[model samples]
Target: MTDPASWPQESASLAEYGEDCVKQWNNVSLRYRMPLRGFFSKRVKDAAEVEDLTQEVFLHLIRRARGGPIEHVEQYVFQVAANTLRDWGRRRRARNQDAHESFDAEMHQPVTDISPERVLLGKEEIKRVNAVLRGLPERTRDVFVLRALEKKKYAEIAVMMGISVRAIEKHMAKALAQLGSVVDKAGEQD
Candidate 1:
């Protein structure tokens, strides 16, 4: 004899509930897993990833079912599978974009020495410029070399030389004008 409220009520334990959901998912998912695998295989090359994605679909169904029994299991499962694939696509796009960014950085610093002849010509030009620079007045040569070879800004050169930016600019102009004539003479020699 038991009170009406205390009478044995039918309710599955958590483990039993989970097992029931898994069994149902297994039975229903078998029919669709092949189709889902085929669908995933078209986009993903690795069979293992396809299989893993398929299992993720079932896992999603199991988690969702834990909330309550789904009324339309097939439709729900397919929808979840589609969402999983979309998520994978988004991740792959982000990964590829990151890879392309690294590739672009490398591309910006290309190995410009594509030919030995170009290398030799560049070296010769540098030698001629060095000879011309040596012939310049000490102050002009220092200013020009700092600005050109060392790639210092005019303001920086001014600070280092204890001169004004305007003075550095004038020195650069005079250096270029003199180098122009020197380059012309060198060209004639060549």
Candidate 2:
């Protein structure tokens, strides 16, 4: 190889291209932020998260624009936003799927046909669950809530909590074992 260091890192006119792209992005950034935020807000209620996602969209566009001059800035921005939304949806679905896979068969029971006795039992069950959850280690409880209640995938939970997926699975298993024992004892009493 002829000198790796001397090889052109980027195009000779890369700075000019980048500068023009930055100008284009600044010109259209404000006009699109509101609409992008609105779109993200519809999917999630958190204002902070919506703002973050809107910023992410712009960042993605900026990266793309730096590669070449965008002939149609508005269209490209919206297209990037749309792609971002699709990616968000895919990740959400995958997380939901991971949560579902971790659940046992009892969790899949249909809830449409509610009986008076069933309602009473459900209330009692909720009380037991809350008590058991309160008794769990802090991380265990958090893992349980995110996986079981929030329906987050183990991988997603890992990323959010800055832990490993195996750790998340361990926490879930511990939580389920504890809860299962409590539920079993309660059933015996009945």
Candidate 3:
């Protein structure tokens, strides 16, 4: 068995470890590269990602060997490979990569129904709504904006406004009644 103390330290360059250490490391890498590729290929679907993961495993092994000699090189390599795969899985999940869809220009084109008449009608409706909202009491308007635009629950809005949930419900009811009347009037005009 070789002495662990003789293994390369962080301070020692790979060249200082002599050609034999380099050759041994190269041999170990070559022996394990194909197996590591197979290991990654079994789990990852993307060919590029599998190759990148296989390379990452060897990088980890190199870093570990630089720290000190591994007692069981084969076992250590596979362990690192397993850990690398697990980390990759965690990253993929965090990024929500599984839910992503590739974009195609034809499929993602902008809607063609935005005619000038529709746009002008939308603007007039927004102005009418804004005028009504402005005429409302401050608290009622605030409750309306918080619930409608911000999508806050009644309890959440109550907590935020330092009011009771019942008060929140009352305010929301009043705001909705006023808005509903405005919508009815607008429909009559149309």
Q: What value does the lDDT take at residue 146 in candidate 1?
A: 97
TM-score of each: 0.42, 0.39, 0.47
Model 3 TM-score (2 dp): 0.47
Clashing pairs in 2: none
Q: Across residues 1-190, which tens digit of lDDT does each residue of candidate 3 receive?
A: 1333554433433343335777766656566689899999899999999899988987887787778766656666788899999999999999999999989999999898899998998899999899989989999999999999999999999999999999999998998898899899989988
Clashes of each: 0, 0, 0
Q: What is the lDDT of residue 83 in candidate 3?
A: 97
lDDT of 1 by residue, 1-190 (tens): 1132432234322232224655545455655689789888997887998999998987787787779767545556568888999998898788884365434776688787679877786788788777878888899999999999899999999999999999999989989988898678768866
Sorted on TM-score, highest at the top, how do the candidates line up? 3, 1, 2
Per-residue lDDT tens digits for candidate 2, residues 1-190, read: 1233432333332232233545445545645678788888888776986887899888887677567755555566667877887887788798884355555777887768789998898899999989999999999999999999999999999999999999999999999999999899989988
**How many clashes does the backbone of model 3 have?**
0
Give the C-alpha lDDT of model 2: 0.76
Model 1 C-alpha lDDT versus the unseen true structure: 0.75
By descending lDDT, how would the candidates be arranged? 3, 2, 1
Clash count in backbone of candidate 1: 0
Q: After superposition, how far is residue 96 of candidate 2 from its true place, in Å?
A: 2.5
Model with the higher lDDT, candidate 1 or 2: 2
Scanning candidate 2 in windows of ten residues, the lowest lDDT window is 8-17
